[model samples]
Target: MENRIHLGDCIDVLHEIQENSVDLVYLDPPFFTGKRQASSNKDGSKKYTYEDRWHSNSDYYDFIEKRLTLCRKVMKDTASIFFHCDRNAVHIARYALDKVFGPEAFQSEIIWSYKRWSNAKKGLLQQHQNILFYSKTNSFKWNKTFVDYSATTNIDQILQRRKRDDRGKSAYLRDKEGNVVLEATKEGVPLGDVWDIPYLNPKAKERTGYPTQKPILLLERIIALTTDEGDIVLDPFCGSGTTPVAANMLNRKYIGIDKSIDAVHLTNDRLLSPIKSESNLLKKGVESFLKKDQWIEMHLTGLECNPVHRNSGADALLKEKVNGNGVFIKVQKQEEKLNDALNKLVKLINSREGFKGILIQTSNTDEFINNESKSIKIIKSISMQIREF
Candidate 1:
């Protein structure tokens, strides 16, 4: 099998991996939901109980620092990592990451902005999550992926202004141009720190049972823009396995680790039976199978009705028709349609002796199913009573 799941604590499992083996790492660790659940009375809302216990600042820092140190060991010198978190612990995680990976390796602090409910009634709405990107080397691979940033007409036009250089190269115009004119290239605009992807709502199709699961598209953009095919992808806290699935679908090898058994199972199922929307260009064949609506039907005729017939026509049909294997040959215009087509085919096979069957279909059929009986199997397409010897 090309894919396999390893169940254990992320920190312990990460230590077992070879040093400098991974090409990319993307992690979405648990956010520190500080001690306090707001309770609403008739008058107003007030903070009451704590939903999570790991609220102490020191405890939170230590939990992340240890995992990050182990993660650093498994990453290649040229590899890059994206650490995802919310406002609760993003600042702390950033500090820890800088310490482990070094300040000079700091790449980008991506702000994933989304439209969601914010409790900041007294202050500006909290509609964004933070993702700190880091690399082991300064010469790491970087591909600038872009998305349509047009919220309104004016904002779009202002952002859409193209710039080029004298050698017909597309780049941000740095200096004033003389008489030399440059041609605009087709390459899209460079990505910025602030990303505006749609938030996971109740109606979202990608919403699994997990409460904080992210969209596959977000991970896809990150993986595609940063790494190439056949590179290794690592996800230390792989929640529902979104990172691994995205990496595999993009033709990249992956290793995902999660402490939760449920998370591991969720990831396994997601990778095996990924939704159609998450299907990438490489999985076009799988998508085609799901969308197939037509079924193959085979018809056979002209066999002498005898208790023990050798190499007979009815025997041919029995040999070819099997369940779930795509072989659908049947007796042509047989009034004795025994209960179902399947049973009839079985009966024909049992009555015939030394009858060798052949498959007759207009199109090539995948060997999905095969039967021991040597009989004919035909695929159905049109309705016509034709005779066969």
Candidate 2:
């Protein structure tokens, strides 16, 4: 599974995959969006769009029921699936999923709220989409994502006004020995089901021309928080191949499928040109150009959190020799400031006997030395973004 796109119907393609192979599944299947045949080509050439149609509720259930059964077969015991849909077919889809994957496997229904351009007088604006998450087994991976609290929420103001304890931290009352014990606030609050992440607007850097294409950030968050690196991700209804693109960027192996030949070609073209910045949605497409080995190297240093070392030897080496994705130098106790740490790390990397490169995670701008500093090159981590020379 070294970055290849499959062209065919999802059910047929999924049947070819081995059982219990995929780690995660994120699908945004065609909603019964009645109009299937639209002018697809840029020059107004005639093109047929694959439309999902159902005459009755049972027909829709039958359609989803068979596909979900196949999806379950391909998923590992610990694998999870996210089905994105709207109100039109969500209930039937849920019923089919429950029958196929079991009710116990039902997870959260993520509400993706966004703005729509419609008159308010006629009816309430439909501004949210639904995503149903399901796991194959009880023992599954779930890394909770910490979304930043909205600025408009009153909770922020309430939190700010709370009194502080002697340690200068926000106070929370505790009941102990019939006395109130004030403690500091926890790191952050749990994210709720009603996510306020806006839909991909026209000006958004990640916007691809695909009408139903989702933001890469949403997929990235799901993939990162749900599974470990090197896990296999599958997207059967891979419209424009966003799931595979996100999986590759996050160092996950992936399988993507689509019935539309135009979509397949569009996805292929999108993956081929890695340097062109079309939009924020397309930035994740850059991962398509990276080889598995290159992805490994980038994953080692580029990820926000500490990279999950594959081997115990690598873990030991990292723990003993590296600090924050870089080989650390024992700077003087007083010289541990940002600038000094950068200089010491750079000097150590340059002085090393046989290392090819060094990645320094620091806030200082002086992390990089001249390129001519022997065979070693510098990589600096400013916040979560990494830059290499």
Candidate 3:
């Protein structure tokens, strides 16, 4: 199949394609949220929007069903289809998918969990979306992907071989002499349905002013799971062309269809460069990013503050701001001199306008600098106070 973007309704495009030719089909249809989804570019100079409004629930279901049927027609027998949606439409969308692909072909209901914060509504924060994975036949292709095991996983489980007991329960394998048997090799834990990818923050370089634009990392995972080199991938609602970009990156040919002309142009431009934002949080585990001074956290326990990580100068920020500015705090390292800590704090104070700061001196130093010139105030750490007293 040729790699290209088709303009117009996805149903028409899918119909024009030959039957059972595509290897993988992925679609992120509108969620029927009863409103238009609009977002502006980084500088707010341009806007991209899509209307999700529907006359009624039945009308929306029918619309999705027709497109899903068309998508099924184009999928090869060994193909897989991933339909992405949220709570607002997951139920109906799954119903339609089940109708097109037999219920037995329904593979997995993947939870694309992410971290999002919103205080406008009084309820549990919305933090995840769903993707329904279905296949055209029982022999659908699936590439095994393994991820790092969670902290709680037992080492023995990862290293030792296992066997089913007579009662059909899992048990560690043993040799004829009753010695514990170990596996010759191991693949890391199989990737699970529930994912924890970080959402695209406001400053993500991949953002293209398109509403509901998924991260390329998310698409990369899906594409890797279902397709291989030289495989064909399809995205019926290719908003910002994330799927196409991911497909191209993974060495697969892709066909992206979208009704919006601007979306097509944006997708083409992305295909030319394929700029993907590297997520530090995803690259390094969350535990690695959360590494900070435990002693500093203990000292600030009585105060309402949040610990800062991955910064050169600041250690924490007081929840209470001073003079319409964030109050930055830094703890002097045990080996650091008092003057050096003060200098670090001073640099941060000067860099951020309207911000005030404090430095906690943890160790005694022979050299001292007058605090009058600097905006940062110097305070003694509790240990220092006890030693001085």
Give the residue spans of candidate 2 off by over 4 A.
Answer: 37-48, 119-121, 149-185, 203-205, 274-389
Question: Which pairs clash in the backbone of model 3?
Answer: none
- TM, every model: 0.59, 0.61, 0.86
lDDT by residue for model 3 (312-386), tens: 578888899887789888888757777777777778888999888888777777895778635588888787799
Clash number by candidate, in order? 11, 4, 0
Q: What would the per-residue lDDT of candidate 1 be over residues 98-210, giving only the tens digit for each residue?
A: 98999999999999877665474788788889999999898787876764433343543344445765888875433365333334433435678987666655545565656
Residue 239 displacement in candidate 2 (angstroms): 0.9
Please, what are the lDDT tens digits per residue for candidate 2 over residues 1-389? 43667888788888889899888988888775555534334334545366766677787778778889999999999899999989887888789889998999998898987656657567778899889989999988888766444445565444543557799997655455634543345445667787655576654445445557777767777898788899999988887777877887788888888888877776676666522223422343334424432534443543333332222111112443333344322211222354444354446555655533343434344444345544333444443354443
Ranking by lDDT: 3, 2, 1
Ranked by TM-score from best down, the candidates are 3, 2, 1
Candidate 1 error regions (>4 Å)? 35-52, 117-123, 146-186, 276-389
| Span of ten consecutive residues with least summed lDDT in model 2 | 308-317
